[model samples]
Target: MVEVDNATLIAFTVLALLAFVVALIFTGLSVAKKSKLFVNTIGEVSAKYETDITPATYAFGIWNLIFIWQAAWLLYAFGSIWRYADGGPVLMKPDILPIEFYLFWISCCLLYIGWLFLWDREYLFYAFIDLFLLTGCGYAAVAYQSIALNNNMIGLMSKSPVDVTLVYVLVQNGTDLFFSWTTVATLLNLASALANDPLLKRNLSAKSASTISLVILGIMVLSWSLIENTVWFDYFKYVYAWYAVLLWALIAVIVKNYDRTNYNSVFSIVLLCLVVIALVVKVAVYASRIS
Candidate 1:
């Protein structure tokens, strides 16, 4: 096992911070000013990129939550590194972090930073690649968090219930929520790319694009069911928070862009099922504990 070096840790922290700040500036400016200025001004018109499958304006508010969670994750990681240097109980030690955390952290930052440049330059195809990479990074982070959570649950030494719960809430839920939304963002990014870039449409018919978009939505809904609503809730308590926030976004998009013929209806219904499943499981678990 390669021990994580302090310099390497510093590099990861700095790069992640840099990526977050840069992505926020570019994304905020792009959305607010409708500017596509990139790499000495090679850009595309953003107006034509709008599509029926695109989530409503309000749905994009997810970025605010994602950014805040990412910032919180960074702070927690940093605190783990320095919390006990002054001789106090170490809430978390750096060595406890799974290797996947470092890998996922760097790749997640690159996904945001690299895609910003690609999108700015109107390279939708390349940006789509980054979106998939982002999904992979999110999945890796989820795995890391699961391992961390398990370690906390089966402590080699006794730990207070409150301490364990605090760790689980902060670490596990943060990773789950972030990953679940990143999965959503990946599909949304794909839809945006398909609509925006005609050059990527080479020989692809309109029916083909719509089919691909629907398929992406299908995958997104199914994954949310399997990952967020089922797996997470079955193991960790109070996973309903991720389900509720995500379900709200799904509903908001459907209400804002209602189309009977569009796949939005199907997606919304599937998401509704996920919401119900999560709730039913939560209530069952609660009743079982009480009994």
Candidate 2:
């Protein structure tokens, strides 16, 4: 039997608490703002595509209900972790695989769910799985985002263009921004997860956060450029890349100055400038090509 030290146990408890808080905040904000956008966008897309699927047809209303349930479950999981730390029985089996493994599995499930949407046929049963997959992935992402931001290992592994491109391909072909955004959201979540971990509390420095944020921001910029060049005329592609870049940039600024009051104002200005330049150049080139 492996003996877990008191310090290690305490650290895990703190980490769980932090993850719970962060997840709660994110979900609350998402539900408040993004959920409306999601419904509206889906309605618009269906209309544009001339699809018969209505918000009701695709169970959008029910999805919000499921999301609330999932958020409750996540809170319960975190509470269980905290309870187990104080000499209680394990709330969840430590025998369960590492968080990253769970994240990967959730990602695969999300991909599957998105694929189901590609068919003209509606599978109402699959909607349950889709909701489950989103909840799982969102939870895992939040739990791990902090950790990855602090550790730098997960983001490093995700550095390769080929690897990132593969993820992008899956997202594109899946034809669902929900899956793509969730994947990206998880990357951010990993950072949040590590931020609250006890072991990493001391080891996770401001510099590390800044570096991780910068790297992710760079990836977002590169991805935006690629999408702009490849699908310049597609409004959807532009919107996707533009919003993704903005989100990553916001994250970078937040992480880069995690401990500072002044924050990365200079970097934020530079990033905005660059984005404008990139957009202008891409648009000009696209127009020239069309002419």
Candidate 3:
């Protein structure tokens, strides 16, 4: 086990704080519908790259939920450090996430901030790369959280009901929600990048690229549901939050592409519907088993 020295801890805290400040500033600008660089707001930039797989405007509203949940978790986690330090009384295993988790999160934040800038500047390929890296970082953080939980490094040491709930609710659920959304966003970014970049499109038409990417995302979601129902059943608690956010994205896409006359739209809708059904059934099965 790597020991976290005072200097390392201080560095992590500063990075996290800096990331939080950047996020808040971006959020404020978004809420105000104002951009420092004229005509470079996220919505404005994304509209320029709209592809067949791009979800409807409402789908992006999920950022509100993501930001709120993330903020709540960060506050609780930070407060727990001062409130429960030295094992004062109400101990919480996940009061402070592991060093690996912080490292991954900080990297994700940096990449996300950079991706915004790149996307705003119309650097589609580079923006996609940044989003890809950000998604990978989110996945790594979630993976580490899973490992910590499975190894009895988090929830296992809880001392109170609040601690136990916070362990899984604020920590696990919060991370999963953030990661799942990022995964969807990454797929959207890839489709947009491919559609806009001539070299990346190659022999594929813009519509074809979007359709293929949509199918890929559908298959990915279905595979995850199947795995959670079988292989990961005992290893980790069901990732209900991930599936829920993904379901939201799929529904938004289906609503947007509800054109019966278009083959690409109809085919992609059917594939995504199948994936949604799989997610629903898997969640029902998990609930039944627990009940």
Most lDDT-accurate candidate? 3
Q: Where does model 3 exceed 4 Å of error?
A: 1-14, 30-34, 37-39, 85-96, 153-158, 198-203, 284-291
Q: lDDT at 191 for candidate 3?
A: 80
Task: Report, for every candidate in turn, its global Cα lDDT versus the true structure.
Answer: 0.60, 0.40, 0.71
Model 2's TM-score against the true structure: 0.34
Backbone clashes under 3 angstroms, per model: 0, 12, 0
| Model 1 regions lying over 4 Å from their true place | 1-47, 85-96, 156-161, 201-211, 223-242, 261-263, 282-291
Candidate 2 lDDT by residue in tens digits, 1-291: 233554454455455445435544544443353554223333343233221101123333433533444444344434444444224423223311134523443454444335234211222224334544664564444334323322433342334224223322332222223334444333333333333234343534433443454456557666857755775334323234344434443544444333333334445455666667776777676678777
Of the pair 2 and 3, which is ahead by lDDT?
A: 3
Give the Å shift of residue 115 in candidate 1: 1.1
Error of 2 at 53 (Å): 38
Say which prediction, candidate 1 or candidate 3, comes out ahead on lDDT.
3
Per-model TM-score versus the true fold = 0.74, 0.34, 0.85
Report the alpha-carbon TM-score of model 1 versus the true structure.
0.74
**Better-scoring candidate (TM-score), 1 or 3:** 3
Task: Return the candidate ranking by lDDT, descending.
Answer: 3, 1, 2
lDDT of 2 at 16: 41
